[model samples]
Target: MADLHVESTVQDNTDHSPQNNEDVQKCHVVVPTTGMKFESEDEIYSFYNNYAYQMGFGVRISSKRKKPHKTYYALGCHKRGVYESKAESSKQSKSCKTDCPAKISVIVDYDGTCAISCVSLEHNHALSPKKSRFQRSHKKIDSYSKRRLELNDSAGIPLAKIFHSLVVEAEGYENLAFGERDCRNYIAKARQLRLGKGDAEALRDYFVRMQKRSTNFFYVIDMDDEGRLKNVFWADARSRAAYQLFGDVVFFDSTYLTNKYNMPFAPFVGVNHHGQFMLFGCGLVSREDTETYVWLLKSWLECMDGHAPKAIITYQCRAIQGAVAHVFPDSLHRLCLWHIMKKVPEKLGKLNQYKAIKKTLKSLVYESIQSQEFEDGWSQMIKEYALDKNDWLCSLFDDRKRWVPLYVKVIFWAGMSTTQRSEGMNAFFDDYVNSKTSLRQFVEQYDNALKSKKEKETKADFDSLNASYKLMTGFHFEKQFQASYTNAMFKLVQIELQCMLFCNHSLLKTHGTISTFNVTDILRGKRGELKRKVVYTVSFDEVGRDIQCSCHLFEFRGIICRHMMKILIEKDVKEIPSCYILSRWRKDLKHRHYHVINCYEDLKSGGHAKQFEQLCSSFYEVAHIANSQEKYDYLLKCIALAKEKLSDDSSWSVNTNTNTISQDAHIVSEPKKPLLPPAQVRSKGHPPTKRKESKIEQVTKKKRKINVHEANGISSVNDNIYRRSYDFDLNH
Candidate 1:
């Protein structure tokens, strides 16, 4: 992106007086120019600065031409680097800023007489309005407004909003001399000054302050041989506690590169009860390698008191895998499902099953419920698709036990399968961090991200501790889950409970205490949905009041699957068996000592909270009054809908209709609209078209198209395809 707008440098009034001013000249060497005589260089420079301001620009003190015993001083536009060749000087200045002929000269003469001259006065760019031109030339924000902006910035306000607020505070748009861009530039300079040079000392200074603020706050920083940062890791006390509660399954991935340094921003994320991404720790490393990974993992493990996660999921990389295996030998290092599926297209492009492979792989990984079933299906796929010879796929199969859902069905992962949470964390920090974000800026941004995530977790914790979630289904077993599970876990359980009603089951086998049922979904699979046909074997220890299903949902997903729930209902098992109630899926995790992080970032977070509440209270009164009027009803409704639509621009839709608001849960009997065709065809704009490529098509090296003509091709004057032959070539 090119910078379209150009500006000239402006300086503030200087204190030194003009050298040729008669205030110091001993009454004889009179001033030659028609400007006010001043005593010192500061006074002379001040006159030039004022002249530059009036001309919509600024001037700087140019170096005086000095000989062996001669001295001369001049003031000119800093953009115009003064030289003997005026053309070259002008060209150099205009190259940086086209059409900006900002040049002025104030020279001290040989007789100690001052001469003021305007060499170049015209400006190509439009001048700022009078109200702001002077202040902008000086680049000074009034002390009060600067303080206000700093206060709001510290409050974590958005930059654009803060600018708008300053505009509002000015009472008039033109009252403020500087633009938003200037305000941003000033803020950047202020932050740079506050952080000092970005180095080990600066980082240590920040960490020391953090430790003083929160005794439990800890950090580990690794430095390179040149005393520069190689890797740094940190975690707060509450975050550590959350890890203790729900860190059994951890997700690791380099979430973003929102810094000038281009550090790998890897965050260790976990799933809270509300299915929100929880930050356990964050690491910024100079590079991705086995050594860096080892150092980061060690720091994280040390912070967690050597309590390793039961499972860790990350994108497949040899360096990360080796480090994980070396450091966390007992923990299951799994492959991210998203990464595996993403790599399939590029890695297996040569295979014949390129088109059907996606569907087959999804079924083989997500649908298959047993290890033996996956083994058989995988082998069959390799044979049918001729994928057995592919080295990449062969390596994947060799490590299937680590990534395939079927093989790890017995381990409890709390339903986490990839660094999708980490990706979301990256997005969460997008509002805070940017390409030019520095170390101090990143710390501030990290606080903002952490605060938002903690707020969500706090909200969920509050709901679990206080509010009662409405039950979607009216069932005793469902109600039991509603009470026992957190809102998020209960939602999953409620979905399974609803699914149990749709399952059509028939007893297939009964031998001793083992019973098998062939469960077929009646409402789904027969239509447009994916087919789900399976036999669920239920082992019932009637004497111990225990039951288990083959789907292993209770064992792995930490939720009772519909298959098992149907069997449990058949067996008249009343409340969820105590053994299946996973505490990790609930807010009430059984940690030795768990602490929830405070949601409010600081005491000043509520600076405008009470004021906003008062406004909301006033609106409530107006809403009540408007509700009584039929005319105001739609208007009030519109306001609410507008608020919702404006609150989240990403999800709100302008085209949402009545059909979209209703659900398919209850069968609504309505007359179907008569089928009609082409009453109104699509507008005659360019019709949508897809460029279909062959299944084997992959991006290869660019090739030029060869146009080989026959040996004796005739060329017509009108035939542009053939070149004209001046003479007979074959005879020669």
Candidate 2:
């Protein structure tokens, strides 16, 4: 059924308004062009469309195509039909058309210009309200508006702001011929169109390329019954390496909606040597259940070469807990304290002493460092608060070993306290995904986000390699740590060093090679109230040169505790033990750079075949000659010199006017690298205006980050997961 696009009112054909008077008189026909016509079909279309609008009519494409004749390109338009009311006339309502013979046709001349050849300006029936009287003029979002909206979306403009901007651009809401819902729906449809299956294919292709470039780039996709993508798991080379080194303790959190697909994005995170959160792997699950969780956990383990982390942390989820127990029975599973305490007010809000109970519960979680201490504290707090009958408190007590800090203090976490690292993971990719983001948009967004993160890591690496923070303390241990740890870790150790100032240590009894010392901490609070005192027993093994402290800070957090530092100072130890340093956080730890290169997927690429042949020839020759370590070293030096010479060579050196060979020497430039150029993403929509190969765009490739075309599928719970492996070759 034909429908009206917008509101319209009938007018008498005899009316003499300024516009009507002009139309009734000899109508001025603005020709497309008489001499130098437009070359673009869109331009020709635009000219006619504007002409129709001025005549209080709407225009639509009739038939615009090309042929091999003199009129190489032909463009045409016709008057748009209207939706007539039933009350006006039965024939008009049934037909919903005036049968107006108002149309145009343009022919492209041999000069690459278009000239209009046919025009019928007169209409059989009275024209309806300007533009809106047409059957499909309601959603006429111009190219300019779409591009503007796209730019705004990519810039992370809030949707509300985008609406305000579009409305203002149109001058007013009435000019838009649409409400906020229409604009939003248009944006949604646009995004879906651009970010649909092409994006999903793009994501798959990207990971395939990443895996080809590096050895440890791991990814797996589970397909549904129809071979559609169900669940996906992936981890990059650096992440795998990080897992190999620092995956002793892990934090798991993936219960948030990042994309429109409703798939949970779980990130396997751990604490690095420098106390920074390191991502080990990530998974996108269509559903969060025990079987799915199991697959994800097993996939993570597989990527890290079946090496399970000694401990795992997660929120209070029965599915996750069951998965962990089944998959990693040997590894201790801990619960996130943050998630537990967050529900405290809601769980215990009915009590009059809820505030007191909350405070006491927090103190119990943080203060107790031993099983005995925790037990004592829990019993005392519950009794005092009259919570012996509280089911929530009893359940918490029963599950204390999994969540209470005191129970898990002995296990190494590299200083991580909760699964909040997963929250940080969410923040890392939040900028990329929106409520309407599609799978393909996710891929582009994740790539950009990951690149930004790696760039920051590189900057940190530069600081660690070239810069140093000044030492605030003269402690010899501080000097050792500053030399070994990264700048960030050294700063943490420095804080620990400063805290030693308030610590008082005394020697206790010595048993053979083991010497014991008692260290007391006395701290003053902001209100001049002395905080709770803590005394720690430090044990030093003279034979092994190993040190241990009752606080177990090093064992858990990876940093030497204040008590141990005080003891060392008292004993006048010259250096920290070598065993205390972890390599993952070292200043010289090697990391790989993951670069995205343009992979010519088709046979039509320019000059790439020759480049590939040359690369293979050069690498093969080098590998063949450099058989032994000595020969390899010599080749390495030669390669270094070649690189240095290339970096130093200038194309246009300053022409010195000095005598003969020139006595004065010019300053050399910084080191330069031979980097490969990035590939351009295939784009959609209007034919590009620029001549250059479509370069990097804000929304890469075909973009919408769209709201529709969601890939929905489910993997079976009982399906056996086989190990998917790839082979590498020493030769190219």
Give lDDT for model 2.
0.64
lDDT of 1 by residue, 476-570 (tens): 67777777787877877876777677776778877776666776643355364745555556566655667676667677667877877777777
Top of the candidates by lDDT:
2
Clashing pairs in 2: 191-704, 191-706, 192-706
Model 2: residues with Cα > 4 Å off, grouped in runs: 1-58, 62-80, 85-216, 224-229, 418-422, 434-436, 524-529, 542-544, 592-732
RMSD of candidate 2 to the truth, in angstroms, is: 18.7
The C-alpha stretches of model 1 lying farther than 4 A from their native spots are 1-91, 95-136, 151-174, 350-353, 418-422, 434-436, 510-516, 522-530, 587-732
lDDT of each: 0.63, 0.64
Candidate 1 yields a Cα-based lDDT of 0.63
TM-score of every prediction relative to native: 0.65, 0.65
